[model samples]
Target: MLQLLRKIAFPFSLIYLLIITVRNYFYDIGVFKSKTPNTPTICIGNLSVGGTGKTPMIEYVIRLLETRKLAMLSRGYKRKSVGFQLGNEESTVLDLGDEPYQIQQKFPTKSIAVDANRLNGIAQLEQLIKPAVILLDDAFQHRKVNPHLSILLTSYACLYPRDWYLPTGNLRDSKREARRAQLIIVTKCPTNLSEEDKVAITRQIKPKIHQKVLFTSLDYAEKFKDDLGQTVDDILFQDKQIAVVTGIASPEPFIQHLAALNLNFEHLEFSDHHHFTATELKRINGFDVVITTEKDFVRLNGKVDSLYYLEVAHKFSEKDKSVLKETLESVF
Candidate 1:
């Protein structure tokens, strides 16, 4: 039935494509002006609507550029506060959004801010920190502020070339727009992806001479931790029946990780960045051992006692890692 509905929505996807094409045309032809800040800026985003491993990639970049004083800007999707707001110790998930709030929590000293207008947000962050380099999270579609470096992410399971427009497919923008990115990353790949698979995927993407393509897999943390900085005992999960709770774009990769570990769990999935109600919290509390993603853990913290989150990081070959670092360093 869902497949039939998507087939019916195929015409709407064409309409969406036309509208997006026209918008890109205006930007390309200089009918729409894009702002370029004096400070070096890097954009990490995807062509699809969600589940591209963008947050983990952003964290990877942050770790790589640890020496530089950094600031991050995001649109703060579904946030309660409006306009340009800077993150601080007092900032909550409602103020900075879940992803940005999670970044702030991870890097307390760094500057994190959110605004729907990329231009305004960059300006505000500049005035506040004058950061060495500004990282723009999920800003591929935001053409107003042109970034010095744009890194595009596509999931290994659903590459952009095989995707269509929104409402019917995962893509929110045209696949052709991928040409704008200087670097393209295939995220959430299997650890044992063969060279033949790489060649085939690369042939499908057909990246330009100026673009570099890379593949990476998710590296799950060895153990779970709580808000109190206490680690959970791995022995407890041994032959244990756990509840897997997630409020993110895609939970398949996380589920697969747990399954590989031979763990027993029932999934309770929700929409991306879902705000839990009091009743829902009570129900979640009933679970014996609840596991979730790091992003979801921030919101669910202090709400459920048995709750634990799995941490994930990006893993790539040393050569590709070097290429990413060198490319960013060259820009600055």
Candidate 2:
């Protein structure tokens, strides 16, 4: 039924493509104005609706620029609060959204703010914290604020070139808009991807001369941590009645990682950023061990007593690592 519906939606996808093409053209030709921030800004986003691993890439860049005073601005997708809400000691997931709240928990010292308006978010962050650089989360298609540098993310398994517009496929923006990015990273690749495969993928992407493409693999942590600050290794999962829970856009990679560890568990997957109901929580509580991703853990922590989260980060090859660093340096 879903496949049939998607096939029927192809004409609607064409309509979406036309609408976005005109919108982008207006922005490009200055019929619509875009504001440039006074502070150096870099945007990390994907053309697709979700599942490009933007959060992990943002965290990776945050770690790379540890010496700088950083502020991150997000649209705060699906959060309860409205207007510009800045992360503080009292900020909750309801106020800043799951991804921003997770980032705030991980890096409490850095400034994190969310507003549907990217320009207003940047201005509030500047007025409040005066950060050296601002990282715009999931704002590649947001043409209202022209970023100084933009990094576009595309998954190795599902490249944007092969995707169609929304309701039929995952792409939310036109593929031609990818040219705006200064750097493009292929996320969620296998660690053992060969050089020939790299060349093939880059050739397939056909990035412009100014744009550099890099590959990254998801590096899961060896140990898992729970809400009480307790850590456990994968060996311990062999004896436990495990339930692997995930509320993320891409859970297959995470599930495969556990399978690679040779662990036994029941998989309980949900839509990305799903808010669990009381009945669902009770169902999940039946398992002896509930494991999830860090982003999901932020929303599930106090609700699920047996919850534990595994951390994942971006891992690049030595050569790609140097290229990424040099590209970021050039951004400033």
Reference-based lDDT, residue 14, model 1? 91
Candidate 1, residue 83: the lDDT equals 100
Clashes (candidate 2): 0
Worst 10 residues of 2 by lDDT: 323-332
Superposing every Cα of model 1 onto the true structure, what RMSD results?
1.1
Candidate 2 Cα outliers beyond 4 Å, as residue runs: none
lDDT by residue for model 1 (50-78), tens: 99998899889999999999999999988
Q: For model 2, what is the C-alpha lDDT against the true structure?
A: 0.92
Against the correct fold, how does model 1 do in TM-score? 0.97
RMSD of 2: 1.0
Query: Please, what are the lDDT tens digits per residue for candidate 2 over residues 1-332?
Result: 98889989999999999999999999999999999999999999999998989999999999988888999999888799999999999999999999999999999989989999999889898898989999999999999999999999999999998888978998999999999998999999998999999999999899999899999999999999989858888776778899999989989999999888888999999999999999999999998889999999988999997788899999998888888777766656
Determine which window of 10 residues in candidate 1 has minimal summed lDDT: 232-241
